[model samples]
Target: MTSQPSLAKADSNPSSPGEPQSGGTGDTGDGLKAGLKNRHLSMIAIGGVIGAGLFVGSSSGIAAAGPAILISYALVGTMVVLVMRMLGEMAAARPTSGSFSTYADQALGRWAGFSIGWLYWFFWVVVLAVEATAGAVILNGWIPAVPQWGWALIVMVVLTATNLVSVGSYGEFEFWFAGIKVVAIGGFVVIGLLAVFGLLPGSDNPGAGFAHLTDAGGFMPKGAGAILTGVLMVVFSFMGSEIVTLAAGESEDPQRAVTKATNSVIWRIGVFYLGSILVVITLLPWNDKSITEHGSYVAALNSIGIPHAGQVMNVIVLTAVLSCLNSGLYTASRMAFSLGQRGDAPKAFARTNERGVPRAAILGSVVFGFVAVWFNYQWKDTVFDFLLNSSGAVALFVWLMICFTQLRMRGIILREEPEKLVVKMWLFPYLTWVTIAMISFVLVYMLTDETGRKQVLLSLLAAAFVVVFSVVREKVRPRVDA
Candidate 1:
């Protein structure tokens, strides 16, 4: 059997200033170029967590938990912050496009690395199809001339071309894409807060106040059990927050960029997820039919007498769908490239074009993404359902792995490279264990619900397939001398 790589020494040294960090494993210069600028990194970090889910999915949580839904957001947000903190600690020490997967290989084993890496790549690729389909639906609504499938193809082709052109092109597109989302959400928060405090003109909803939080159903109207259930509803929205850490490896100063992103997690969650939801519930009663009927954000805007609020939000949702598509394509490809570099995938995937983009890797991910889209249309009931359910719980699994990886990675850094510990996990070993237990509880809790049980079981089956493939590949492949 092939031996596991050592976490302590896996690209532990930082690259010299002003040079592109090697993208391949073990200091090899055969990888992506560091063409992304600081502004691009900053915006991607800010916008990475703001997905279409937040805009569209919050209504369900509000309907389920009432004003107490804030507790669910805070609980899940705290878990995300802790997870990102652990990731930031290792990423700052040894920045890599592989992100946590590389750390897993070093700390756990080749089996762990191969399985989690492929699982993550699969997750993003499926997300590509989901986001592409969503964007196509919105575009088709605007322009009836093109069919939904045609629009999906067009969106995929355009983003795939952007990724192929160069890493900078991807960064430039994401910066603006994320910029619009940040502005829209920020504006929503400001306007919603005004409406809540009676500061906005022509805005006087009698129910729009903090009193709505306690008066309506008296907080935890459905009982405290629903708060834990609410976690199942909102936790998936936090999946994309780790993209910044992955993008950091290709930046001019990976450590600095990662440190900045890690430090900002508190406010990002505070203002964006928790803060925005707080305004929404405050502006409209938790039980307001419009909150679920017209959607939470649109309902809040409508309550303030904003003209064309639905149309405005539709445009923003389309932007979010496209942004997710763009980022998903980039993420899946880079992960494929990382897998190749680590010898867990075909070596050709490690090759870069003149523009320093992993052409093969990008195309490879898109190919599967296109396939998934086709399945959505051709076999929506059978094949697509399985694909969707199989990947449903991967985010939770990835978080679980991150928690485990951080526990071992922290000790390795302390013993071998203390100076590189620029970003540390909070209350190491203690909070780390707490995070692990929390994740475990969520997984167990999922088994009780019918839908959640199907998702978790199917995801486990997919993970098992990858683990078996990894083990078999290790056994049959030719051995290399240490």
Candidate 2:
């Protein structure tokens, strides 16, 4: 990490008519130039969308909604596509290292900037903690000698060092990490579809038809209620998808990179998420008790008599966990750096080291990862559950902020430089509002589900915390003299 922490500026005083304007441009480090290539960004878009959660957590969602759970993936994927389009429009214009948070500040207000920036920073820091635990669990399950905590410690320290080197290195690292996941999941989908058609090595079990959808209990075995429930269940798996936009800020051609990634992200998401889920459902009965009993993809692979299926899945899940942790640390550090630059966080966070890494932000995020490990180790069931529930519903908050920023930013683009609108969000405000309404409905439905209710409640508290901070800071800042 850079010794000079790159944080948002501490004083968010807007440039007055007579005052000289400065600061708020992002990533001041020197070791790395903006050199993230298009290929690197493309793989990130493809691989980042398919998180390990799809393989593991999607099982519970499938169990809840039966075969129709494919609808849940389709629904959430569409929402994200619209959201990303909105984000793409703004990013194509500004292309700052600070990403959405800085855009929120410039478009919405200083308060919106600070709140979203810090909240996003907080989100990723917590994710670092959570992902470390996940990676540790997989490693421990595989080796059974080194404790999970030790493995987590190793993962954190190594990734921290990696981020501290340079942004280019981090991009390169994520490129490969994401590439492995892409190949694995993509291959799984192909193999799964083949097995579904009864073309695989063993065809004892009838899998080559849509009969799996209705074989056990028809499409909505648990009723339509569970499909709404499945919406909440599968949404968070898409969390890492937004990181591509953040990294694009540091790319050599931010506008071009963001535009290309944004344009293709929807189809990529549809293929990876909807396509993969479709294969899973067609290959196995959603109502099969084993679907709910074991990890989703792992269980299905076992059904197909794949050799070393569990171990293979354990490796894949472990890779996804590590990739997420690496990205989480990077995201948190960059946000804090942006916050410092914007005058919302301590100024030290804005400084970057010789290698152009945000040293303080990286270490600070890693410290949180360690703390989360302690909580996971000590409380195991309850505290872990609480942590998961609290952050679960904030996916909407993050996405909504991106959408709103884009709405305001679009006008700014026309007034300033219309040339940058090379990549645009289709059906601007219309799709924007539709997306928001869809998110709101999901929130309302979540409030009604007993399981998702906990997540909704915890998320409300988190948003309240953000709102209170924004209000207090707005009140405390000195008024500008005319």
TM-score of each: 0.95, 0.90
Consecutive 10-residue window with the lowest summed lDDT within model 2: 1-10
| TM-score for candidate 1 | 0.95
Q: lDDT of all the models against the reference?
A: 0.86, 0.76
Candidate 2 residues 1-482, lDDT tens each?
10111122312433222333333334323222465777788887787787778878998898778888888888999998888888878777766657888777767776677777877777777787778888888888878899988988889989988888888777888888888888888888888877888888774446657778787788888888778888888988998777777788667677777888888887888778888888777877786677777677876787777878888988888888878887888888877777766567765676665555667767776777678778888886787667767777777788888877777778877776788788787887788888888988888888888977888899778778887887787677642311
- For residue 129, give model 1's deviation from the true position in Å: 0.8
Per-residue CA lDDT of candidate 1, range 329-379, in tens? 999988888787777887667677656788889999999999999999899
Which runs of model 2 end up more than 4 angstroms from their true locations? 1-32, 202-205, 380-386, 478-482
Q: What is the lDDT of candidate 1?
A: 0.86
Worst 10 residues of 1 by lDDT: 11-20
What's the distance in Å from true for residue 146, model 2? Answer: 1.3
Q: Which of the numbered candidates is closest to the native, going by highest TM-score?
A: 1
